[model samples]
Target: MMTIMRKSPINVRAAAKEASHERIVQAAARAIRRSGYDGTGVADIMKDAGLTHGAFYAHFESREAMLAEAVDRAGAESNGFGARVIAAVPAEQAFQALIQAYLSKEHLAGIETGCPVAALGSEMPRQAPEVRRAATRRIKEMIDLVARQSPDWGQPGVHERALVTVATMVGTLMLARAVDDAALSDSLCSAALKRLAPSDA
Candidate 1:
């Protein structure tokens, strides 16, 4: 009698499911960051992930579900950026380091690898409810990171300052990206950074 050769269907199913799901989430995050929430469609995200649109529902209950997961992953990936910014300087130099990093020419030109808030914040409020909530939480976490680095600031006022700092950084980048004049863009970022720098720094 010849022995039967076979593959384990359960193991194969598990591996395929994990790979496909991760692919979909990664593709969605990239597309949403580049295109904003409304601009990226499920089909396009699936196509970019090398999976069929029909496979989307197997991983996500809806586009909103995918967006929520994508936002969370983006947040986690970006979680260390602010901490890294502050860690690279003396206490007196922390704010300036952050300012320079946020406003630099490299940041203005590199959206895909930089701040997700700068890339996605304007459209965030308009996103699906789940996406909006995820974005809001990520923004809070970023603010908290900046606040944690500054011991000189009052506890109550730290959050407000963080928000203003983030807004200025994001807005400066947005304006810089919009204009045909490269000089104007650089000037706006430089001015904002100068204003936000700690008085002693």
Candidate 2:
């Protein structure tokens, strides 16, 4: 005879609670990127997650705890994008594709969903230790991803080269978005492509 396994009431409630926690973290991730760290509030995050403010304490110990989780989620989303770009092309062309994708018009306009470091780097130092720690860990992973893409992957200077590349891309995009002139914005990105990716970049 075949037997069916049923979840206990405790397990069902635990799953529901876990789902709510995930919803809050996802919403907070987007909120921080969209509105900056200082601008995102617990009430706003909870509301965006379709939960009440009173329920927030059930999911997190403090505002900083939620923000820390948000940082991780945001970093993961951005890193996932980079990973996909590298995977979508041939090994020899992967690095160029990542550079091109990072500076593309699509990414340029996608502040809330793009790289967390580029979006929140300036504000990172002021965050709680846990939040900053989370961001720092993700940033290291991002740099590693870039470095591993280098043709000289395990070479002596590849890590430094990856550092410069990431810095240049982030700075260029930040400047491009800072300017109000559409021409300058396009020019900034074009100039970066000229040096970073060139052809398809």
Candidate 3:
């Protein structure tokens, strides 16, 4: 005899709601990355998430609220990837490995799945206060992650160095993406990587 597994009605509804919420956030994350925060529309995100526009309020209180969550989600995703990259290499070489991976051409081309700081940094200043605060918090988290891998991890100036390193990486990637010339783009990334980690060059 074959047995069937049946979910309770409440369980089914709860699961469906969770799934829908995930879709909305994921869609918003992608949309905001492709388009700046101001450019992303609730209707477009809902449509991409396979939901109608009217259902947005059921998942989020407002557009700004959804964007704040999305920004946090994007930062978490990037930070998680960075952690994995660092963890995959030996501790002594982890920093250089991360620099290489971050400055690679692949990362330069992958805007949708790339670093949110590089993609949205410029637009962040104009965003709502809550959204800007969320981005700022994530930026600090990223800087802290880099600081932990530095030689002067516990030193006072280590965080400042990490801040500079993160800024250089994000700035280089942004400039590389802005230019139309392929060679120039690659050169910009290479120059930044070399300056930041000469031994890795």
Give Cα distance to truth, residue 30, candidate 3, Å: 0.9
- Write the residue-wise lDDT of candidate 1 on 110-189 in tens digits: 76666778788788767789988887888888777766655557767887888787788778888888799988987998
- Give one clash count per candidate, in the order shown: 0, 0, 0
RMSD vs true structure, all candidates:
4.1, 1.5, 2.4
Model with the higher TM-score, candidate 1 or 2: 2
Alpha carbon deviation, residue 85, candidate 3 (Å): 0.3
* Better-scoring candidate (lDDT), 1 or 2: 2
List the candidate numbers ranked by TM-score, top first: 2, 3, 1
144: Cα error in model 2, Å:
0.7
With candidate 2 superimposed using the best TM-score fit, by how many Å does residue 83's alpha carbon deviate from the native?
0.4
lDDT by residue for model 3 over 1-201, one digit each (tens)? 999999999999999999999999988888898898888999999999999999999889889999998998899888888999999998988888888888998888888888999999999978889898888899899998888888777889998899899999999999999999999999999889888888833
Candidate 2: residue 86 Cα off by (Å) = 0.7
In model 2, what is the error at residue 137, expressed in angstroms? 0.6
For the record, the alpha-carbon RMSD of candidate 3 to the native fold, in angstroms, is 2.4
